[model samples]
Target: MKIWYCFTPLITYVADTPEELIIACATMNSLPVTIATCGDFGDPIQHPPCDGSSTLANITAIITSILPSDLIVFFKACKHYNLNGVNLPFWRNWFAANPSSFLIPELLHHLHKMFWDHDHLWCTTVVGSQEIDFRFVLLQVWTDHHNVQWYIIGVIAGAAPTDFISAIRALMEFKYLTEAPHFTKKQVVHLDCCLKVFHWLKQSIVDTGAWWGKGGGDKPWAIPKLELLQGVVPSIYSHGTVMQWSTDPTEHVHIRVVKEPSRAGNNHNYDAQVCRHLDRRDKVECFDLILQIYDPTLMKMTVDKAAGNFSLPDLCPAVSDHLN
Candidate 1:
């Protein structure tokens, strides 16, 4: 995955200084990975924002300038305007197909005290067994390309909630989470298969408890999460837990890997990038587990069905720079 990060030093309120860069990083805490502050800034820097605040509106312009971004980050300056943070609703969604129309102010006020109530909404059923939950979605959506197929070979697993996905959607569609008392059908919120699928697949395993350190001796610290990753275990095996939904390998022996296939098709480079995220940032890591079970070349993931209690991550905005 190729991600481009851009920031106008002015956004951070400090230009050409370490303080400015640090502030910019602090502004972009909503997404994983570091920022490559280009256009005005040189080289990609590991930017983890300090406080939860973000310059979202100003950053939107920079993100829009770079079209076709796998992901985008921003910093907002509501403080400069003396307004509380931009009151982006908790349930608004990032409508990639229609970004501009995602939010409306009157709608925000209406959503202020009620649960989401969209009068105009449509829902689609992901055709699969009720037993299959969020984990299967990752194994299924691994390769975005049409040519590469996916398969689940080794052992079968069970369903688990991907908190990362839940967090992102909650933020994007907060306004649409409930109906605007003043207007009906003027704003609509619904599940989107394509956008939510990709968004969550890249973001699901982030900051989850399942992702622990590899034993650094003292306090076990988690690694940074990456936008892309792929892998094969150094080697392993175990003999425990016989359920179908667990990624946990209780049998003492297991293979854990996350690889990112470059557009250039260099698997080795992809592996290095994965390591950097897992080793450096201390963020949670997500790998497509099905590959260890099935062959990548033979069959492809044809029908991904999410039965019950399952939905796409972007259905609601989950992450925000509102907190530190």
Candidate 2:
């Protein structure tokens, strides 16, 4: 009888003594693949800085490790190998927070919940928000969240940095107004930086020139800055903040809860849609990458079903490496 057979290779390595994550790539490269190994990971292995280990870093490394057509990472996250990991307490607390209860999350959620924007980039021939010829628009995330709005401003790149004197001078031209106060200064910005963005509401001013502003002129009252976070991609900026902390190398904390029906049925597919990147066409599928400082003392991810335990470092090498 003619039979069809399959042989699945195991591309696995463990880093017990994690440094800057040099060992993982070194192993994957220095070692040779038997018939069991996959050839997608080329001769030269390139990676960002790593503080030994992290969840997101592992996830990204495996994703880019394969060829264009391979579906290993998908199958691993979706089925085969269970993720069995979670963020530290700080990150978990951050997920449950909103603008009203923001400060603590900064303390809880890995010191930062930065949003890395893979959309609205200049390199994609994508026009600036205002310059769009089409009448594209969006709905509010929540009506009650009053100050949640995008502020428009001009940005000039490749210029030198501005000192305190230049900053005040620029503000003079765009003089502040003394209008009747409807909202307090706190409502204008929800930053927990301890480094205040502005002093008052009527004179609500934002630091538009900082490297975070992406060269755009900002107002003290702009709801979301949309430029604080940075990425390796040039001309591309993210709209979020970051944090620092440590989780126990042994324990685990859960944040992403996929229901049974979701995991076994169509729910997973639905999630794949909603969490899709703003520019799905870029081949940058999802924004599942969650960065946090590598802390072996906080919490970790577990199967939560039977007997399974894993750290974020066991998964995300790319993101973890970069963030650290």
Candidate 3:
């Protein structure tokens, strides 16, 4: 079976440097791995002993030699480039043509401006700012083993649908190929849904000239790119399983786990922060391994659960008496 691997500079928390990460990958002797990275950074490709000339071709050749048929080296589309290419241009043209569109009664109802609650007051100002300062896009990669795993591949500072679209397309292709050699009926359905959504997105861009639909009087519309990507869920259920091939989980990791630690000291030495975090992780992992050898049960408890447990009170006296 083909195994997937992803490479992203954003995963600096895992390794201090791209070279070290590549070395670790090279040492693995199991399933063939795919190394995915954003096209923008020029990392791994532009960094280190690998010459900058013909970098893509050289990286491909090296990975191919290592895994032959099993390696998948994919360069993700650049989010910043895509923002300029698609989103910004569309929004500019549309906004200039229909400045009043944002003020439409239907749109206003959905906007934070109409919110009555004080708690939602912040939303009103943010909504207005979003139009002027549109900057937030994330690209993520996901994989599945016993459980699915996600990683933030890229986080672009712009309002763009292209990055989201590109990620979906890439992931769908990966899912299709990995499940190949043979595909279940449900897998085929899932793939079809992916294609449908992909086509719908392309068409939406063409038809609306924006990522969202042009709302009429009472029907305000906001395009839901992420929601549309969930079109694969029903097919997943039909297939009787779930896969970790989604960005949602990885996004959570970024916000809760990686981002805070990386920015903890508010220090400018980002590289040192990453290195220190990785060093701590390594030590923790090593300690866990040692514990596993000497105290397997303790290790399991530490990893999976707390040390104490309490029984529930007897629900029915008759049942409790029988057990007693």
By summed lDDT, the worst window of 10 consecutive residues in model 1 runs over 228-237
Candidate 1 to truth, TM: 0.15
Over 4 Å off, model 2: 1-127, 130-256, 259-263, 267-324
Please give the ranking of all candidate structures by lDDT, highest first, separated by commas.
3, 1, 2
Selected candidate, larger TM-score, 2 vs 3: 3
lDDT of each: 0.26, 0.25, 0.32
Q: What RMSD does each model have against the real structure?
A: 25.9, 26.6, 20.9
Q: For every model in order, what is the number of clashing pairs? A: 70, 42, 2
Ranking of candidates on TM-score, top first: 3, 2, 1
Candidate 3 colliding pairs: 136-158, 148-244
Q: 1-324, model 2: which lDDT tens digit per residue?
A: 989865433222211211112222222211111111122111112222222233335445545554324555444452221222221212222333221112111211111111112112221122334533222223323322121112111221112123322332222211111111232345223222111221221121223222222233332222121111111111011112222212322223122223322344454466664344223523332233222234432225433445443434545566544433
- When summed lDDT is taken over every stretch of 10 residues in candidate 3, the lowest stretch is 80-89
Better of 1 and 3 by lDDT: 3
Q: What is the lDDT of residue 199 in candidate 1?
A: 40
